[model samples]
Target: MSKLFNWYSGLGLATKQFIYLFIVTLFLVMVLAYRNLSEAEALLKNQVIRDAELLVGRTNQYIDASLDNVENMLLLLSTRYDLFEDGNEAIAADTLRKFADYNNSIAKTLYLVRTDGKVYANEQVNYDIIGNPMLPELYKLALENYGAINVSEPYYSTMSGHTLAYVLPVTDARRQLQGVVVAEVNLDSLTERIAPMIYQSYALMTRDGNIINRLDSRDKMLPYQAGAYPPVLQESFREQLEAVKIGVSRIEGNHHEMLAVVKSTTNRLGWSLAAFIEEDYFYQGLQQLNNNYRTASVVWMIILLLSAYLLSRSFTKPIRRFVEKMDRLHDVQIVAKLPVTRKDEIGRLTQSYNDMLERIQTLLHKTKSAEEQKKEYELKMLRSQIAPHFLYNTLACISSLAKQQRIDEVRDTIRSLVKLLAFSFDKQSEYVSIEEELEGLRMYMHIQQVRYGEQYTYELDVDPSLLQYRILKLTLQPLVENALFHGISPRNGGLITIKGKLEHGVIRLYVRDNGIGISRTEARKALHDQFEQERSKYRFTGIGLRNVHDRIRIHHGVPYGLRIGSTPGVGTVIRVGIPVLTENDERLGIMG
Candidate 1:
């Protein structure tokens, strides 16, 4: 079994699929053929039985009607008033002759025998029946019966070759026997009466098993022969025949097989009828049906083989294309997207593959760009390092020269400018103590004050308790510069103020300026312009404001950012919100 599995596994996918399909098709065909043949045989057998039962029922009705006709005739003869009362023998004879004349097909001859055993014909003339021993025996039997009707078994007579007799006794109202009336019926008349109702071969048999009369399929008579059939018959090629109310059995003759359906009258006649049909008549069509099934099976197998080949290709072709494309996937080579025409599992797989390739290519490009940018920034930092030290030295020389010349204001201004530039270049300390930030802002504002003189008077009213907390370096310096330039530069004497406080676990810082205050609309435009690449209408360094806003948000999240509010001809206030923290906070000394 393991070797067989290995062999099958070694075969190609299409070959395996075709083998499975072929096996399934063969099994289905065999099962269908078997079931169809079985059902056909069953249906044929049932139809034959039903047809046989129907024919037997019709034959029973015809035979029973004939028996009834004979019984009615006997009753009519027995009921004659003169025959029962022994009054007017001529009238009784006339009544019998008229009855025979009217029903010649049923009663061929009618006669009467007195209780004394004297026989008189329907002609009213007495015959010497004692001289004939056979006639005397019939009268003697009638006398013994006395009052009841009796029918004789089939017999041959010199007058009527083959005949059956009906003997009815005459009795008065007191049930006293008078005479016996006998009616001789010709068997040929029975055949003529039943001729039109028979469409198949039939035999009428007496209780003693003698075949009284036989009729062919055409209802024509065959020669009379004595053939006894018992209440039951055993045959080699047929089902057992028994004296049932109705029965059907098969019979194999010398040359052909036949199916026989039997029904017994079980009446005064002591007769039964059996109908026969040839067995080959039903099986001939079954042979033709088998040939048709064989032809159809061959044709269907051929079609299934062809269909299996095509269906197998439909499955394997797409998979082959996917494998080939995957084989060509490499770092330097770009694989083309597969075309998806169906919404099946294979189509989804193709789509997923294409998306995966695109993400891989995008990450590759981003990695290369990040590497290049890292190198450029490293080079710029090294090149810019020497200039800040040189500027510091120059500022120191100017400060020393001004102090010797007793120019205290110029000396202080140059020193303040040097401190601001040094602090701006301090990249190592991204966060500084709030006190340090305030000190730096004081220095920068002092330089602006020296330049602008009394035109810009600023106040710093920060909560003293918040002076030790850490804040982002250079955050407040840019906002202060914008207020001086964009708010105060346009007016002669403007006030700039800085206020800080701790509220609701947050630090609120506000920078306000009272000058030629911008309108609310203009303030909104200024804030929006800060985020743009270009400067605002006042040519202020909006980039500085945008930088401070972005740094605060990036470090503390969007919840804390710069907010601007102002009114026309009124002071403009810029507020900044940040989570309040003490010296022990984890983020106190961290770089922004």
Candidate 2:
């Protein structure tokens, strides 16, 4: 809104600059921090996934090796054909008991079952080989895969909490189907042998998703399903588990996210081994890294903000000083120059301002000198005019009148001459009111009219309101004299008109004469005082038209000066322009 813009504009320059710098820098810092954090997270997540995969893969290898070892042991024992011979039941039983006792960590029990319904075990027990619930499926599996070791899925056994049956069929010399030597493995013990030291949780499951054993419990025999284990191994990860034979995946858990790695055993068991860890737990270092990054970013932002503020202040400090100095510069008398302390734009501006002040002071001194000279010149011209033909003519007229006893006419003519001399010599001020200048002009014209009676006539037309306006002393008298001598005098007699008016803040004075006018080239040359050398012999006053023009320009500036309009054989009109300066107005200095 306009209000917000106005408010911002009203703020100090330094404050606004600070805001601009800080906002831009803050945006860039945030973007960089976000990018760095994202990259770190991606790298950390990848490391966690690789770690999970390595852990699960190693555990799977251990389980497969253990199963392979058990199978090899059973196959070695099957080579002992004497255990299945007609008279070697005691020996076979003793052999089986020793084997079970020696490898008790893996094998819980050993059984020797014959096709003839004879069943023997490591422990003394009476059992029907065909009727034992745990043995029948294993027996059929052994027979179908004859001469090769076979393993069954985990099953519950009363004696052992969870057990797997490894069976190897015994054959005769004729390759006849005899009985099977069975080993009941404690699944819990086997899983413990393959447990990894760094895993949070691990499980072994059958191809049909049956839970064989888990690290959390020794008696976990339920089918694998949701809620049976950690949520990492639940339905969210089940799809990935079935899709890949060995790989790692990220999945959502109950409260957080987790990484799960699943790998299937390479042996005949075809069991999958999986290990999982929470993302937060696995990448705890990454979390700490993120925290450190955030802390550093905050500190950097604070530093940047402070730096921006200081820089903005430093940049605007000089400008503010310049403005203050400018505000104090109310008059030429009190003007002060600013110091240049740097080579920047502000410093350059200061230098320029100082140069301007010097130029103004120089011009003021020159204008004052010129005004004094002009006043002195006017007085000199008036004193010199006393010895001229005008004085002779006036004296002769007085002498002629005295012989005729015209005493009143002689007194008036002498009084008018004295008044004219006194007005020109008055040194009261360089500038005088328009009315005073016009009064002086009237005195000068009265003397000329007395000498050239009936030869020329003069008229005055000036606005009353403009008479109070001030102008340079003796400014108009020279122009009127120039018209009288150059234009009117050449024709022996002519009518002269002096007009004054206020036009657009300027005081314009026109002196018109219906006399033999000079050419335009002569007018231009006369205004520049080029014709003064030729006309000096006949001119009454040394103050020429060009002196009037120069004085006006120096006081009022170039825009307000004299302009000439003339027509040969017709008339000449010279206009003088000057600004209306009242008593309260300061004398014009430099325009700027």
- On TM-score, the candidate that comes out on top is 2
TM-score of candidate 1 to 2 decimals: 0.36
lDDT of 2 by residue, 1-592 (tens): 9999999999997889898988988888788778877787677767766766776677777767766667877877878866877898889888888888888877887887788767777774533332356776778888887677877877776555578788988887778867888888878787676664435666677777666764353322212344553222455445555665566655444444444554545445677876656666645676787788789887987898889898887766677778988988878746667778889787888899999888998999987887897676556555554336655676676677678877886677678778876776677767889898888777777667666776878899999999988888777877777778878887888898999998887788999999888888887887663476244333345666777777677656779888988899899898989987887674543221
Candidate lDDT scores, in order, read 0.67, 0.73
RMSD of each: 46.6, 47.9
Candidate 1: pairs in clash: 209-228, 209-229
TM-score of each: 0.36, 0.39
lDDT value, candidate 1, whole model: 0.67
Model 1 lDDT per residue over 174-237, tens place: 7777677787776778776654544355666777765565334332222222353221222332
Model 1 Cα displacement at 148 (Å)?
Answer: 99
Top lDDT: which candidate number? 2
Cα miss at 492, model 1 (Å)? 2.7
